[model samples]
Target chain A: MATAGTADSGSTVPTGTSSIRRMAPAEMPGSSSTTQSMKKTIGHRGVETTTGETTYKKTTSSALKGAIQLGIAHTVGSLSQKAERDVLMQDFVVVESIFFPSEGSNLTPAHHYSDFRFKTYAPIAFRYFREMFGIRPDDYLYSLCNEPLIELSNPGASGSIFYVSSDDEFIIKTVQHKEAEFLQKLLPGYFMNINQNKRTLLPKFYGLYCVQAGGKNIRIVVMNNLLPRIVPMHLKYDLKGSTYKRRASLKEREKAVPTYKDLDFIQDLPEGLLLEADNFNALCKTIQRDCLLLQSFKIMDYSLLMGIHNLDQASRERERGGAASGDRVVLEGPVTPDQRRPQAQKSLYCTAMESIQGGR
Target chain B: MATAGTADSGSTVPTGTSSIRRMAPAEMPGSSSTTQSMKKTIGHRGVETTTGETTYKKTTSSALKGAIQLGIAHTVGSLSQKAERDVLMQDFVVVESIFFPSEGSNLTPAHHYSDFRFKTYAPIAFRYFREMFGIRPDDYLYSLCNEPLIELSNPGASGSIFYVSSDDEFIIKTVQHKEAEFLQKLLPGYFMNINQNKRTLLPKFYGLYCVQAGGKNIRIVVMNNLLPRIVPMHLKYDLKGSTYKRRASLKEREKAVPTYKDLDFIQDLPEGLLLEADNFNALCKTIQRDCLLLQSFKIMDYSLLMGIHNLDQASRERERGGAASGDRVVLEGPVTPDQRRPQAQKSLYCTAMESIQGGR
Candidate 1:
């Protein structure tokens, strides 16, 4: 989400030297130093906006660095759901968030915050289902998500995308075309914005593309590949209330620490990852806050998702009346030949599936 | 997600030939028990597939549902992460298997021995997201989800519908072409097949229309006038880090359960919902399983997000080099305004915003 009150967080302005970390007892990673290091914290001037609100939302999301692991395809494989005994390879997507440190400069520790000061910026988090979705029946497909996608503050400047699977994966995003052009250029620009923060919070930019929409083009950024992973508590982890004692026992403390590798997502970290950089924990906090704390599945909030799904459901071609007896809903997308590496495609599917199983 | 092989669940068929419950659990003001107790469970009857491998894949996901909740969303919510302040929602279109139990033929569930057979059906379910969208840097915009949307799963059936949303509150679905033909010919046939399940698992049909794709006329499914509701979690029960004294002293949990006005979800839920559902204990188990579960983010994951952000960094005209942008995405949709209730969009926005702050 992007807007004036949102503090232009997508771009950070560097203060260039003064320390923002307070001198109180602090927990700086790796240093374990007795003296407080030059830790960085965000320094907000708190600008007022036309609505008389200081429009920056402060919700934090997980940083990009840890996401590859959360969304990669599972290493152990997927667990089957039936009383059947066959083991299977699960194809799923997974999502997670982290936050950059708040109030930081190039000189400080953290750099990004999930909360933006813009009305346009909705906190990027998710939660709940039937208990909530069923609460309002008339409002059902009013939105398209049982899970929340990232809410945007500014659809024009920044936004998120969504995809669905019926027979073939259908990618639907309400993101505008202009943004696509922006991504084609700005990816490298922003990568260079806060060199240290970028290094700490995410890997360097790789590839970006612009998608066309409504007679225009939108931006769809592609970065380092994310893998998908799953948390098969039945087969792995706490084991829930299963009759399988061995499985649950093997995962005691492991439950406290999520196992990141699986078919849905991978564990590939950014090269030269840091344990405690300025933006590292901030992104982690963002993941905890936006992706974790306040997430909820609401009935009418499908403006973003339904906007896309509705289009799909509404535009479906009739089944048998096409003057022919055998008609199939055929979609022609640019295909990647099998001879080439299909790594990216597989990784994305994994992340999305794992996410469906667990994330939001 | 569509194929597999495995041992049978060996669960006995249900006893006394009870139908599945399809209504909203009798909270719709005037619903009768007969309506409320429509088809409830799909005791898998081994759908008419000639292939056995496909059957195994479908059942596995169903069996695994009992294992665990995505506890990571909750644990991260409780963490001091930065993004924890707003409401978050995620969307997942999963390929899952559902059963359609036969109506009360003379045979009791006891007689069937469950046949241990479940008719394999693919429907989507939404898992709850906490307050935000997590970062899985490895994901791509068009990558992940892989499923197809058929205009009509059954052409000759009326009411042969499927549920699409997790909340089941907002959207109900059915095939559409010409309104007159759909109502007169298809609705009943479709409903008959779906009505077999009877639970609110499929979307209820609402209206009809046609869309143009590749110049062919495609019919759309009009779902009943239902809005997806927020999966509700009572605040009193969600006191995350309270001590025993704080927990006991808080009057929140002791207060009468709040009910939805026109909505029937939580309000319809028998009071003492958490206790009734045993979610408090369930919460503990979920928490223990998914903490620290994530790995780092990858570059490819943030591609779309970053790509768009980058696009905006430059003038659209500039990115296009003064030419028409190449990625022009055209969405031919329900040209006709969806003939559902007109909602006060702002009312929903308010509820959505507040939901973020109060949710877990």
Candidate 2:
């Protein structure tokens, strides 16, 4: 919840400027006994500060968090486990992935099923994705709780939070309490979209979970991170196909690698995203079909997130004798040979990123 | 066409006993000049004798036959060509595979396309089949005229003929001239059935071709030979779900391995086809769904072709010291380690056959 002073403020306050006060358990009204150890209630980690940042610090409780995370991961994985083996029976099959309270565990209840909260509509389509796209169960399992989870602050919105996997492979999005229910209601149409169109540029959702945090159910959506880590982008743009109120704020533009908007992209590079003829045509065709599909679903306010990796920029950085050059400017194609690297994760997001130019 | 003398007879005659007289070209009106090189109008190799058995003779024309066969193979292959690479765009893309007249070609008046000729319904569903079932190009290319095509005689049907690939993998069925047109019309529904259900036990079709043979366009459907030569079945049944007029002819039953009808199966084995509980249940579920799909299409008079191999019978034959036993009774599974044999072909039909015997 936003504090009294932060609530009325139209813009987010920078860090260390807000009036944050730590209230004693006795002084705080309706405070639970467990709140004694919950440090600095006003602006603590996971607790949103006036800065609009909700930090995710790795605590000793991370192990427990990992277990909770995997519980949901395994549930989603099981949804499409035997998908390849039984395509016919799974059509009418409605198997729910539910988690109940364990005998001595403090975790609350949650459910994550295939069509309702996972990629592809049915188990068959999920199986198709697995078989065609080469997405294995191990990738989802490992990426969920592998090492340190990188917390990313939501720029403008307050209380909006997300965490990217350490490898930058997946993003765990925190949705509103009602958004989970809304997504469940939209499951059927979402499934139909997947069933009808084998190829789509839409986000490939892996699972959705309801985690009980601070005595409230927080909905989380696990999906492929639009910006991958293997090939870092020099510039990024989020085009909404509109010019009105599309420019990034001055503070946002001050970032080292800020995401530009439609207006900025048009003003900066008027030729549009210059791709190879074949690639450009293919991208346009896919975008058109995906747009029609979204339009059919009555969806609006979606943006085309484009990332550009300038190879020339990398070449210049290399000549400048930059430190950690190998790690920073490693220009490689998006299609990593999964066969050679057992750890390499394959997702539909890679296909979207493939349009990113290497040289031009 | 059946000769006048043979036409009246309801049953097939023995080869040596019939008049065996060839009608002259002068007697036949509208016969092509190419008929001059094609000997024996009444009966010959590939041409059915009164006995209704045609011998397949490998000839120098096999090369030319391969070319004509590739024309259709290439066409159907073209239908699902972009399937594997572009699953996304293929959803809305509609492409027709047409084979028109090329100058300096021996084949005259090329007009093999559309429902009256080729196969390709909703390219999306066909694309789905290609993508989901892993149907590849090499399956069609190699199966058509890969080796000396082995001609198989159609029992009791005088002019009906088919050829099994020399490898005995696929059957090039000589569909009736108009039947191809009918199938083309039903392509949309058929494609839908396949797209909707990935586990249907129905024949998996690879390609449809129209080859100019004997001065006429002969439409052939390339399908997995249900009675595969590699794993020979001692007993076979052609079970039409009906009872009336469904008995095999005396001449047909006289064959070493006759295709018994539903009546024969009930009389011979009243207990019904013995299968493991899981296998039976799985098979029943698939059959039920497939039947519904067929019913939706208003299709009737379809039969479930069943082939059973008695392993005990093979054991008994082996004990009896039968000659040339090496070529017969390969009880081993069809999935040989292909790493040892790089040329081994992989087709979706093999997967269909894998579900045949889960247990007894």
Candidate 3:
């Protein structure tokens, strides 16, 4: 019954001159003057000229991050109070929102964040999905909020921002409102697929949160980082099985670790990847099933994110003192016996399905 | 419907010679030979003579602490999955148990601890109670398990071990089996009183856990620490309002920061505490309500744990470079303006009723 923005405005932070800066047409592409004026009139008190632009930007960014963390922590923390039953259809439409005022009281002390509104969609469904994926609440929070997330360069043409958790265990990607709505509608089937087949190579979404701050809505999805951090990826590819415009851009190919597409893959490996008969069958079957599900939902333009780790190349890099340029070596301390065993047993070529997401 | 110990014994640690040492009559007072032999024969494989007494003890202790932390973390983390409704009568009888075998697998990895059994009594009701007390689940987990609990010297004759949270926000006290059972039986009424009277001075019991390890059942109750960590207490007292043998022993009086008894309180303050008329009435009403509730349950031998902070002495101690030896200065670094406000507004004589519990 709690529709978004229907609740009483708990508290509001004066928009200040920052709003004007944000309303700059050149800065916010595609934002109309009408939308800017509407936002400016909603809770505008007066122009705050004393605060510098840099200070205002820093405060907003810090507050935005803090609000996101607090929202995720609180939502996940309260998951256990719900019944351990299958999520209902209505759950997909359910949205829980909490408004945090800038000025806090005894009951709600002012945390590190400023005024912001946080909303979580289909909390119960997400909770079940997270549990099915073996994601514990405490572990989730410790991974996401224990340290500041490392911002990753957004490589997509959609201009969406991306952040990787400090532990490299999860990725928080900003999504458009339409994409979020689509994901919500896809939940029931997604849940069923995961429940039936644990080996499905789909993106494992742990949570979805929307932080509304400074007259902007930032929606983010918390998903498992498919690529293993311990292994240094030698080659990466985004395969769509399509030939038309399915190649990396010239600029993209110049990057240190470019995501080579179908054309590049065929040219680089003329024979293609060799796998055991059983593994090949399993992989094909899973991909077929996943594609069928996505097609049924009228979803297209999805690509399989893949990472390849070459054992020989990794060993050579190790012998050369450390990983090669552009290769990330996350492990800090001396390798333990347990970690060493995996490296030793790894074959010449190891391919991993990172994730499956629409819009590449 | 899962009765305690009815499920398969997941895995257990080998008792080894440590069990024999634990069976020493001098160390385990009132433990009968029958109980000891019964435990030994139940899982007697062979005596681990190669492992030294010190090493075995360290391992068991570490495992015990680790198990306790894991149990608390897992239990609290899973609370939100339950329905957010009024607890039912059957909830009081509900007990959830988990067994951590020494040898863990892919599903349950070997963490910092070894084999142990953990039982949580009326988890749903406790979760509700904690929510009512304004304790967030994430905050609870952080305070209880973020770091090692500081072991406190037990002052009671009940032989209950005590541990204070690293943040000084909570106290974990080991309770006897009978006491745990009594508390479980008293839950319905306790819940009602606290629900009706938010100002009740009764002990804020957040969690009750039973850890079975080394052929022993250790029950612990997590409660509010009562004393403010920021302001050091200059004096402390345990008042039962009874005169018969209600005096601190010579040995107890010799220690610095000794918990003065009813007689010592009377001798120290002949005129007794002087409070404003409104505050006095409110305090009397709350105490009376709490006492009536306890008496209705036939619970007796309760005491009010009180701490007093003296501004003059605190200032003198501050002037002398730091706090006196007896006082604990928990806050490090420069004091924030928010924290300093309390000290400035505090009256000359500040009295706080930490908690009221039976068998104090």
Candidate 4:
């Protein structure tokens, strides 16, 4: 989740020699080749890079990525066995610290050291989530974590990187220490709220870990991908219901899959979607309760991430043998008419039916 | 789930000439040496063999066992990919059917050629269960299923064979077609009930598959073992809440680890467990709801499987270095005083806190 404070106040795209200078690797220590390649790759794919290494280095998750991944693998593998199955209970979430001492090698400096520690706040509470969300450790460890990680050109606020698991079942995002601590503090209450009310549009948090590497305290949290795993969203919006700087920059708008904000959303759909009486009341009640929960926690500036997938357009595009990209993308496999009955109606995202009453 | 139709009326322990007649493998055209070996191995482990070849062959799961196992592996593997992640929904759950054509045999009669087919019912339901119960398919298909299937002389009703997964996380049992059909009919209702209530003492059902092999239709259902995975139960009772012929026979009791029934439980625990007012009320409500669910389905003669693990006696026996017998059994690893707080309270079987009153 990106913070509102991190968004650029004045949008200016860096390019040419300035971009090349920003892409230099040796300037930063412990920078992965993947991130270097990602900037150039996304640039070629026609997405402008805003946050450079200088700003990114201040709050980097790169150093902690490998360590957190290993820690998760080790903890999950150990806990998966019969002897330690119950060890995943609420209090038993803290594992022994994993330390990688400085090797004292010729090229490497002695001051550099890496250590990782992970804690599961109310793991038993999250176990309920594991049941409902299907984010089991096996799915993460075997199906996704075991494969090579792919770092993407993140659409999130600057200085943050997002890594999608090979199977795209889970997302690992770098969070500032303040956000991590806030989540850790809010977890128990968040869990209680979720346990009581199962219908909410809030993001599902899975695991949290902190890494001490490259003289930076990088905090990371693992969460279930908010986007539908099977259905590709043709359009996405990050709406905060606020007017101040609530529009995507021109550079962000250049991306094939840019996240539009509240102004753009309002401009496109002047008359909001109309719902049946009962459904409208239920949605209002859910939103009210969610707002109360957030208010109780004194949390603010959080946005409601929304996605829309046009089924008919997706089907027609597939029928025409069009390349899957942006509007033409089809994430889930082909579904026969019979397969798209009541089951499709049950999906959370499909409930966001956009009945565009009038155009912008 | 045990059915009333399968319970035996008589108390005789079928053995001697009857046992020899029952063990006649040549009489059964589709009998396998593998099944024979399994019986012998389990017998050597000190369990008696009352359900021999004659009764077992009549309701054989042998032909379908191999086929079902392979089908599950194939299904889980194929569906484990990213494209199929959402296939595990509330409604969709069947995997691809596996078929094996009959082949002419050289060792036996050509007229006895048998074909096999297997299909898993609503695998998505089981996938949800896998997430909740923490039983990963990889652990089964790779770690346990790849190992040789070891058949055990089931303490269950006669002629029913039981197989424990190599890792002992799951149990596989063969059922008669009638029982299988009854369970299939009950599943939707059963699932709905479980979805609403989490504290019910009902056994968790995982998968149900029917195999047409060995010229016989063998129905198999996989379920989570009720007994604690790590802790040993010195005494186990399968109480049907009925008195008619409910006690184990003399020969059955002669075994080291016999499954005592209703009469045995009553005879031993004349004064039942005492509970606090709130706990007693909650328990009564749970039992009442459970019975109503069963009655609505017109189901009868189900058992409440119980196991007793005396903490103090077990500790004392271990301290004295006693031989591992019924009284001296130890299964749960060393329990520190600190660990005895929440875990001890949460155990499904640990309500054996009847040490408050005088014991037998």
| Residue ranges of candidate 4 with Cα displaced over 4 Å | A1-360, B1-65, B82-95, B100-115, B155-158, B275-279, B320-322, B326-329, B332-360
lDDT for each residue of candidate 2 in B1-360, tens digit (9 for 90 to 100): 000000101112111101111111123223222233343332122423343333222122243345446464555455545533322322333434443343313422333322122233345544445444454456545656356676554423333345667766665554444555555554544554555555565655554455543344554555655555454567766665677877778878897777777788888888886666866676776767666655554555356666666666756666666332454545433545335223324443353445433221
Tens-digit lDDT track of model 3 for B1-360: 000000001111100011011112233334212232132111111112344211122223345557778889878876766555435445667999887776864334467554778899999778877876667777788878878977554323333445677876677766556667778877766665664455666666788899887677877778766554565656766676877787777766776666567788899998988766655666666677666666666655556655566666776777776658345553322223334233422211122322111111
TM-score of chain A of each: 0.20, 0.67, 0.74, 0.67
| Alpha carbon lDDT of each predicted model | 0.21, 0.47, 0.56, 0.48
Native-referenced Cα lDDT, model 3: 0.56
Q: Which is better, 2 or 4, measured by lDDT?
A: 4
TM-score of each: 0.17, 0.48, 0.41, 0.41
Q: lDDT (0-100) at residue B128 of candidate 4? A: 55
| Span of 10 residues, lowest total lDDT, candidate 1 chain B | B298-307
Least well predicted 10-residue stretch by lDDT in candidate 4 chain A: A11-20
Q: Write the per-residue lDDT of candidate 1 for residues A62-107, one digit (tens) a residue.
A: 2221121111111101111112111100101122222223453332
Clash total of candidate 2: 1
> How much is the TM-score of the A chain of model 1?
0.20
Q: Please give the lDDT score at residue A218 for candidate 1.
A: 27
Q: Give lDDT tens digits, candidate 4, residues A158-180.
A: 34455667765466655555566
Stretches off by above 4 angstroms in model 1 are A1-200, A203-360, B1-94, B98-125, B128-360
Error of 1 at B31 (Å): 34
TM-score, predicted candidate 2 vs. hidden true structure: 0.48
lDDT of 4 at B41: 25
Give Cα distance to truth, residue B311, candidate 3, Å.
Answer: 1.4
